[model samples]
Target chain A: MTTENHPIDQLFKEKLGSLEKNPPAGLMDQISAKVAFRGKIRRMNQVKTAIGIAAAMLLIMMAGWYSMDQTRIAKNQMPLQIPQINTPALAKTNQESLDIKPTVNQIAANQHTIQTTPAKNTSLQSAKPSKSLTVQKNKVVSASVSDGASLLAAQTASKEPSKAAKQEENTVKTKAAEEKTVVKEKSKTESGSNNFQKKNPPLYFADAGVVKQTPSRESGKGNWGITAELSPSVASQSVSGATANTTQQSTVSGGMLASYQVSKRIKVSSGIRFSQMKQDTHTSYTLSQTSGITYLQPVDKAANLAGDVSLYLPAVSSIVYSNGMKTNPTDNFTSDIAQELKYLEVPFQATYKIIDTYLSVGVTGGLSTNFLVGNHAIITQNGINLSNGSTGNVRDILFSSSAGIEVGYGLAKNLIITIEPRIKQYLNSVSSNDQVNYKPTQIGIFTGLTFSFN
Target chain B: MLSVTQLEEIIYKCREENNGAQTALYRLFSSKMYGVCLRYARDSSEAEDILQEGFLRVFTKIRQFEFKGSFEGWMRRIMVNTALEKFRKNDRLYPVEEMSIYEATNWVDETISSITADDLLRIIQELPPRYRMVFNLYAIEGYSHLEIGEMMNISEGTSKSNLSRARIILQKSVAENFGNEKKLVKKVL
Candidate 1:
């Protein structure tokens, strides 16, 4: 007979065997789908928000530049307008001769008569002699001699009366002379006014002439001009406690650029742009792994410059007025937002040319489509075995909106070489993942060419 | 009742988020898992408590299972972990042992193999806690002396001695049950 078995073993085996007969419950279905869908929608909204904010900011900047450009044109034209006013005044003075000719001749005749009459009165005063006066005999001798003398004196008296009359006339002439003095003073003032009018003619004429002569002076100065610029810019940033360790991420990537004018500044450009940007980042980390003893290790290294490209549909508008309104120009190249990859932005820059050739500074800003293509992962363990097993996966979206200055010089009439170091900072935290902590903002540099046209 | 292929399929499907498969899986494995829980428990009720908790954890962590080795081997590890946890909780239940004079008792070949399943079960029930645990793990559960040593944190020699003592006690009880059965047979005759 077979050896009898312990009943507990059979019971244990039976219970173990009986597990084949039971099963667990089902899971809740709709909640999981809702969570996944919400994740996709949230990602899309984040991208749109980045683009929208960039567009609004660009619009504000372009508007500011356009207003400034208009003011500049007005200032340049103001000096030229002065000459226009002077030219018309000179022409009016020439036309005034038609009205002044008759008055001039009449005044000359009156002046000549007044001058000769004064000379006759002066001679008559000199010819008169002083004499003593006696009574009757003196009057008789003076009468018989006075008869002859009387005749002579009467004649002389008559002559003297005539001379006295002439004197009276002379006194009238003096009064006339006084009146003429006022008229001459007025004519002198008129001539002085004409001289004042002559002085301003050259100012208005020269300013207007310079402006007219300068219409094509900036011929090679269009949108594609090479520009070389250096911007000493600084950004103040406060990162969250989690991102503080990655603070070496702050960077300055600006350089001198020379660019030519591309076109009459873009009023608005509605097209796609392909942009590629590269960033060489160096990170220094000090990691201590305490297995038995505390091992302190410092790693200082630079990562290869990574390239990012974005396809942007930018609604680009000009910063300077095309048809005198703030509205953008109606052209094939004009749009409301200049869209491109935020990281790899082909900036449909609305550039306002401040000056030309020697030192031209333009403010260029546009919209960018922020898309996250890849990410960097940092696995850190503090008293936790982070790499031991499959604990969790962390996903973050860093550096969404990209912006910076593009400064350079005009290399030629049609080419502007520029260097743009951009900063892409995330508006929201990169990690929506609750399990792991991550850092999200990044800075980079871009160098490219611009073609300008008139 | 489930074949190995069936168990593998159920676990795979459950990991893939199939509800019907998960339920089938739970039903198929629950009873045997209950037995594993019973070994580490002080009573049937405690065993049932462990069964529920163990199954819940097993299902929750099932996705982490990489099909590298035998599924049964994995399950066994989980059951042992559960048992060790119970032992830690009930440490006070183990009776204190005192060294005494060395004497070997008569070891009978009680012919336990000839006894009915019910009689053998009664013999196991009559054993003290220390003896029962040792005997169950060594004889029925197929744990080697070394494995038992590691699990209970004792020397392998201690596991061997405990198993030997438990077997002797179980043998005597089985002999008595047989004697009683013989008397009943005589009476019936």
Candidate 2:
């Protein structure tokens, strides 16, 4: 049971126990490199986690702002309803009541002469026959009939100037008595009529010079809008300090944006978006095992421009090709590797409108902060995933700037459909590895529907 | 050779992650630790790997050493544990066959004296992974069967069996190689 009594254990221990041999050269350097690399990786992970938390907080804050803005807008809006009246019928009734039979030819001839006087013509021409001049709450029932009597008095004055003054005085006195009677009738019918009459007051006409101006409905339209945009993006990467044969593949990007109209010509927006960059490279690699884990190490490490193309293979006993064929592991093999890098992009953009109309055109430009969210590298032999691993040395954050020309068509009074052709270029390299500089560029046609709110 | 006071100073500096102190400490102990790694590794490359990995653990976890015992002993334990982890990861993928127990052969004292440590190391590296691990843990490191079994994830009975099998193989190899040399020398005389 004891190793001391065992002859074989004793003989081997006595020979090998006190032996010492110098290790191979450069082992210490390798350890130092690994330690520094691991430290960098830890720092990058911390930064990534911080960015993720900040992005979540921004989303929550934006949602809170949107809900509060909706509540405020709902509280500030008031409704006004105007009644429709037939202008010609009221004019005929006023003629019969006054017993004045002025011929149509005579009125037409006097209309030209009335246009020569600037003051009278301005007052007469500015009147809208079908629209109400004033709105009052539950007290304007006979306002339309009074407006008709005043229009008839004006036409009669154009015919006979002396009688016109007396006619207008009589019309005003009669309109005052009718307004008092109508107010008393409305007061009596208030309880009998529906609640709509209390909620939405009626429109009425006042004397020509005493009319109250209604607020323009177009004053604050389209001040704030939310847009959901989707785009099919084409992504490409530019490399410096290294050479790589890579072809970029198309991917999809989309996000929701909230915009505020700061002025008549300028608008600003901010929101979160999802974007990706994918590329395929045909390269040669050798399988190297380290610490019981096998790595598909690229033969030309210098060609690793993006830092996301390294593959770690743990238990690759056999390789299966795309045609469902198996092969033993070799020292070196040529394969197509696809590298995908996805980012959570937060963009701050501003647009300047060139033409604001039913159909609008604008120029847009801004910058975005891109946080890396996904990194994957797959080794495939004719479209088969033989082995999959993650790339290393990717930066946690990247900054990109974009510009575009936007064309939009108004789909409705409060909705517009827009198309933007944009190009985004990264300002810095996506890889943290000092030997390689990999910056990606993206082009997309973004189309979105915007719903406007005051 | 480093004095006790100098070694303590190096440990303090290493705790602060000073690169120079780490190099000094490694220079002081790496030869002895590499000798330890070679006994457990199958080849020189694997021994280098174990050395690198073990030293990294030592430098990163030096703050926890607490100066409770010999710093050298602590580093040796880390090297052994790193080797054991590598064994556990690889043994499942490349399972070794059980070796039959060989009859033990006795060799004269002169023949045993002729065998160098390098020759013995070459012989031990040829043993199966599990047997080699058990033999090193039991014979050189002075671990009991129970402790070896717990570290290697095996039953104590299995550990004893492996140690027995390993001794038989090593005993047979030493006797054959050196016993033939003794026979040649006597024939020439």
Pick the DockQ winner: 2
| lDDT of each residue in A294-404, candidate 1, tens digit only | 111113211111111111111112212212223222321111111111122222334444443434444444443433433322212221111101111212223334455
| Residue runs of model 1 more than 4 Å from their true location after superposition | A1-454, B1-6, B16-19, B96-128, B179-189
Q: Please state the CAPRI-style docking class of candidate 1.
A: incorrect
Q: Return the lDDT, model 1, position B68.
A: 82
Best TM-score among the predictions, by candidate number: 2
Tens digits of per-residue lDDT for model 1 on B1-189? 778788878888867656577556556556556555555455556655565556545655678788889776576567656666666566555454432221222323364345554445445555555566666676666777788777788788987777666655554454454533322121110
Scored against the true structure, residue A41 in model 1 reaches a CA lDDT of 62
TM-score of chain A of 1: 0.26
Worst 10 residues of 1 chain A by lDDT: A205-214
